[model samples]
Target: MFQLDPELESFRNDARKVAERAFAAKAAYWDEEEIYPMENLKLMAELGYLGITIPEEYGGSGAPVVQGTIMLEEIARVCFNTALIAQGAINGPSRAITVLGSEEQKKRWLPGCVRGENIFGIGISEPGAGSAMTDMITSATPDGKYVVLNGQKCFCTGGHVATHIMVFARWGKTQGPRGIGSIVVEKGTPGFEIGHPGPKMGGRGVAEVELFFDHCRVPVENLIMAGDPDSTRSFKRLMSSFGPERVGNAAMCLGVAQGAYELARSYSLERKQFGKPICEFQGIQWKIADMATQIHAARLMIYRAATNLVDGFPDPLEAAYAKLYANEMVQRVTNEALQIHGHYGFTREFPLERMVRDSRGFSLGGGTTEILRNTIAAMVYGRAFDQRAGS
Candidate 1:
């Protein structure tokens, strides 16, 4: 049931070749300079990776969610930064537009995104509103034919390069989730600009900068779900569309974990200890065993989430669980991998250190593990969580 189709397998092989080439050329530079891989990104565009999940009508491959996850996992195994960029730029916005955008919006936005002409970014997490969407201070006021947006969006990936961003803000409504609405804002808008890009310990090649929108005007037609401001239905719709993005994140995390496990397993066999290969040692073998077990479980969870998503009945809590498990799983696996390498992993000479740093970011990105736990508990217990009410 989880097997790849022949056509998808062919695509995966092609993507693997592209990922291998990227690994050979940009892997070292990405880890060393901590910079974005624009050259590799250009190559990805040429290779059609940027549009793997988009429809053929929109200049994309129209690959299913499972295939998309496979591509992300394969690329991430070689270069985590590239995987992050592909997943963030291509998967998130492409899926969002495919699921939520109007026909006109789809025609206007998806072709460019799939063609690599329009870089895309997601603007949901805010400075104070992370994990709690209700706390976002960003507001939108209705104008004659547009909405005036004013707010700060922090930790926006593709911040410096995105040609368009899906901005979420409270549109002067009193309710929490009901007031939230999303608009597509193009770059170079009068009041739209990015703050200084923040340095990150991992996934360094992808820019995470703060977006400031001061009286930015967006056409009402750009709204993904224009509706009454008193209903949570719109936000729910957005979340439904966002399911694939979360699944992509889980896939990337699984790739990182699998990569680290492979590295550590190889090193254990090659590196010598007091006697035979280190793999002969019980401790090293045990570590490798645990790493493999955890990664296997992570992969299964991610695939299950992806399958559920494709069926149009995704459980957000399951996606969150997959993301949470995979994120924490990668961190552990990478750390063990680094430990297997001893001092060599500590230096910049090997990719292990970079993998460790990259894996750490998984825990914090997407939906954080801590917050996802709450979401899981809520789903299992069937109760709304109210921090204020102490539920």
Candidate 2:
């Protein structure tokens, strides 16, 4: 059995209690009305969840990524949309700045983020480049004391409401991943415009948006890892942060699955069919058993990946495995849980339908399952290994 340290366990318990009291009541309403849970975000900030993994010196708790993972899981159990908001608000931009930002940049940004006064968005995944990040056409041109940005970023989670964005763009004339580096663009900067939030099948409240940068200029100091614009070293450093990002993604999936399982189990015990509770039936019992087993397995995978984070970055292979398995596992578990609810599960009256819709996106986000499979295989058989027959 996987176990959390006492501190982490306490954090988990507090997160669960907070979610039940604060997030649960508003979850269905937010999903149904498609409104962002602003009040719940304030509650999270008040509880110190907004700064869970930030350093204490930066007005944060200085907790490890594991604590963040535990809290994310618990909060996600009650409201996946709120959890999504939390991930982007708390982890996405904060992790990038923590790892890549200079001391001055950190001093300027980290404190507000920890205090929930600043929310940030991640800008990558252009329309032309989703999985193939190296193909991005977004260009950052070097000029005296500034870099001019021109391109568009699509599917940027939380972009509509972000105070700033961490943008990944090609620097100068360099090509491919070698040319890619990140820079911070403050909201309302000249020539930087955020589009209307795009609707989604799940994660309703958090707005995914498109960012357009035409001759957008930011101070040279905004460049993360300021050095040669074409340096692959800087790009690789940014990519390293993806490990923790994937781990957190896995934790969200686990939470969703666990929540669905609990609902199904409790409903089974109370719901009757043919003059007896469904829990007494062998078929229902077996389904619940399988759901529990898978949820446990996913949890173990998530924790194993989270604990293995080295200097706040997870081992790429382990993170990939955890994300791949956990994402697919949640889809299956949610489906089974919905099955347990019968026809009622399909109705909005029950939360199962919402869970099912939310779970569907896990496999696609934070690196698609197919992309993760390739990453895992590359790690196992060397990056140059080919699976073709008779090679």
Best by lDDT: 2
What digit string (tens of lDDT, one per residue) describes model 1 on residues 1-391?
A: 4666688789778777878866646776876786888777777778788887788988888766778788899899899878877896556866788877789988998888776788888888898888786778788888999989999998998678888888888876556777777888898988998888788788888879899999999989888765347788777777676667778888988888887788889888899978789999899989999999999898888878877764353468778888888888888898999999999999988788888888887777667778788878988999977754465
lDDT of 2 at 72: 86
Report the Cα lDDT for candidate 2.
0.85
Q: CA lDDT of 143 in candidate 2?
A: 94
In candidate 2, clashing pairs total 0
Query: Model 2, which residues run further than 4 Å from truth?
Result: 226-231, 384-391
Q: What are the lDDT figures for the candidates, one per model?
A: 0.81, 0.85
TM-score of 2: 0.96
Residue 112's lDDT within candidate 2 is: 89
Residue 116's C-alpha lDDT in candidate 2?
74
Off by over 4 Å in 1: 310-313, 389-391
